[model samples]
Each structure stands twice: as structure tokens, then as C-alpha cells.
Target: MTFSIVGRCPETGQLGIAISSSSIAVGARCPWARAGVGVVATQNVTLPALGPQVLDLLEHDQLEPAAAVERALNANGWSEYRQVTTIDAQGRTAFFTGKEALGVHHALAGEQCVAAGNMLASIEVTAAMVHAFENAAGLLADRLLAAMHAATDAGGEAGPVHSAALKIVGDHTWPIADLRVDWADEDPIGQLDTLWQAYRPQMQDYLTRALNPTLAPSYGVPGDE
Candidate 1:
């Protein structure tokens, strides 16, 4: 029902996440990230608490992503239907899909990321997402978007994508950019890509201003200025 990317921006040294789902308001349910801490995507039978708790544990010096995931799962009151992925500050990653998770499919972890998507037509979607995240060389946001695009190309959620979101935390906890269409006529992933491109410049300006407001104001088309 959902596809998401959770990762660290290699260039900006920022932690971020992006997600889309056929379900409404996927933003409210799918992605979570904390700069200088970690990222988590708790989907399928989602667990809301895993979002904050994983970052909490990582901030406490819990560097082993697998251990952090295990502890989080253990504490989850609803584990049977949950699917979770956690990436710590060190880029260590881990994932878990419960027995009762939709379609019963799970995923594996690699160097800096983990991925899981249930109710997918094939395992290739999840595999391709993780591969893109691991192999792509660029900013974390680009890499994360690539992972999501790969999954969409690989057949996506075995259904439609209705809602999408991107969350990045840096020196500031507030999202540099966040948008959720909630519903779209078609090609929601493509719509998300368009929104990302349209928003990137403004987001960059916001971050720059936050870091040092003395920098020149964002220059764009005369109308936008």
C-alpha cells in the first residue's frame, strides 16, 4: 500500500525520508526522520511510536541499527502486522516485516539503507529501491527519490499511488520542504517529482537563510521574486 525512501544526505549530511501510498494521507503514516539522528519508515501494519523511539534510541548512542530495530519491535504493542525500517546515524540499517504483514513479503538490509514494500506484484520493486539508494551517488534527497522512482518503475504497490511526502531534517528540525497531495488523478509519483523540482530551490533558500540569513535572497524568475 506504500513505498518510501529513508536515507541520509551524503552531501548535506542531512537525514531525510520520502514516501507515497495508495492510501490517503500517507505523509501522516509513512515517513519519519531526524537530522543528526536517524530515519524510520513504519508501514504495512504501521506503528506510530517506532517513528520517534528509533531516533530516541539512536541519540542514546545505539549505533547498531539491527539492535535498535529489534528493541523497537519488541516494545511495539502491535507487531504482528507491522513492517519497519530503521537507519541510524552511522548509516547502519535494519528492517522487519511481521508474519501477518500484507502479502507476507519482507526485505534485507545493506550498507546504508533497508527497504520493504508489501502487497507488491513482485519482490523486484523493493529490491530495486534499496539498490538505487545504496548505489546512487548524490545528495540523500536525490538518492531517496531515485529509490522511490525505481520502485515505481518496478511496478509499485500493486495498486495506485494516491498520496506522497518528503521530509528532511537538518540543523533545523522543521522540514525544509513538505507536501502531501493526498489524492491525485493519475501518476502520483510523477506528480511528486514535479513538486520536488518546483520546491527544491525554495527549500534550499530556506535552509540557507536558517544557516545564515545574510546570504543573498533566492533569485528566480522575476514573477517568483
Candidate 2:
């Protein structure tokens, strides 16, 4: 039982995924992205390796989103048990909802985003998420957060969402933003939003420290000033 959105910032060539689930540790299992490559979300029986396999196709074969998704699915024997979405660096989107999908399933695609869900309260959840992402302002992460909230508002999974995550990749090989609530008894989405707000302002500062400590902002915590 999960809902997710895979998106790209066409202007900045950034890729991201926002997801929440009734399952535990959705962040570690469902979302995957590589800087300057693409993003993929694998759920609905959750074949985690399929995410990297799709990325491999996109990066090595230089395949488009559609081809990458197709080949990745074909390589798996349980295609009908998995649901996946892919978006290449160019913002092209593609998805597959298998025959054995749980509960109700919906997949909606907008400009450079795809929102999908299974065991949802309503099929309209994905549509609302996609619309919110398309219209949300600010950075790609902002749009992804908007999508996450929209999904909750429209009707999330059939049950309460216990874990939520946001994964984003920009110019670095590692994710520039990887925030997660491994488990939350209440309002994991709201918890994730709070984390984003606190993390956003210092994001550049952390990067600066990694790239050039001399230019990094102060730690603001100890005797050193």
C-alpha cells in the first residue's frame, strides 16, 4: 500500500521521488534516483532491484523512459506483480501497473511528473498528486512535497501511512536531499515536510563543507566561531 511521485526539474536537470506507504522503511526500499541520469519508484509487491535495473538501462543503453521501463520489466519474471514508474533526465515519463495490482490503482502523468498509487482510498489520489506537482512553485523538491501532501488530501492508501520519504539528486552522485521517516505513528507526511523546511536553508552549507571546508558556513554549535 503505497503512493508515490517521480519527477524531474527540466530547468535544473534534477530528479526526485516523494513517497509514503503503509509499509515500513519505504524510503530505503521504494525510491531510487541518480544525478543526471533518472529516477524510479518500485512498489506494489516492491521489487527494489528493478529500480536500479531501470537506471542501468537508462544510463548504459541511453534508453528513454519508456524503453528503460519496458526492458527492466521484461528482465523480471514477476512483471505482473510489480508497479513501477520511470523518468529520465530529459523529464520523459513512463509507468507500468501490473495485472496483480492491489486494491485500486491509479497512475497519472503531468508535464515532467508521474504519480501512482495502489491500495488507495480512491483512484483519484494519483491524479490530484500529479496536478499539484505540475502547478507547485519553487524547486523540484517543493513540487514533490506538494505532490505528497496532495496525495494525502485526495485520499492516501487504504490504511494509515506509517513511513514517508523524499529522495532528490542534483549535480552530485549522492542524493543532495534524502529525507525519511522510517516509521511514524501519526502524520509522517507532515513530519517529512518539517524536515524539509529545516534542511532546505542549510542544504548549500553542507554541500560547501563537503566540497571546500574553507568556504563552508559555521557549524553554529560549539566554541569555534
Best model per lDDT: 2
Q: Candidate 2's residue-wise lDDT over 1-225, tens digit each?
A: 999999999898999999999988999999999999999999999989999999999999999988888898898879998999989998889999999999999888889999999999999999899899999999999999999998899978889999999999999998899999999999999999999999999888888888997897777789646
Q: How accurate is candidate 2 locally (lDDT)?
A: 0.93
Which pairs, if any, clash in model 2? none
The TM-scores, one per candidate, come to: 0.87, 0.97
Task: Name the candidate that leads on TM-score.
Answer: 2
Q: lDDT per model, in order?
A: 0.77, 0.93
> Which ten residues in a row are the worst by lDDT in model 1?
103-112
Per the 3 Å backbone cut-off, how many clashing residue pairs does candidate 1 have?
0
lDDT of 1 by residue, 171-221 (tens): 677767676667886877778778887887687777777789788485775
TM-score of 1: 0.87
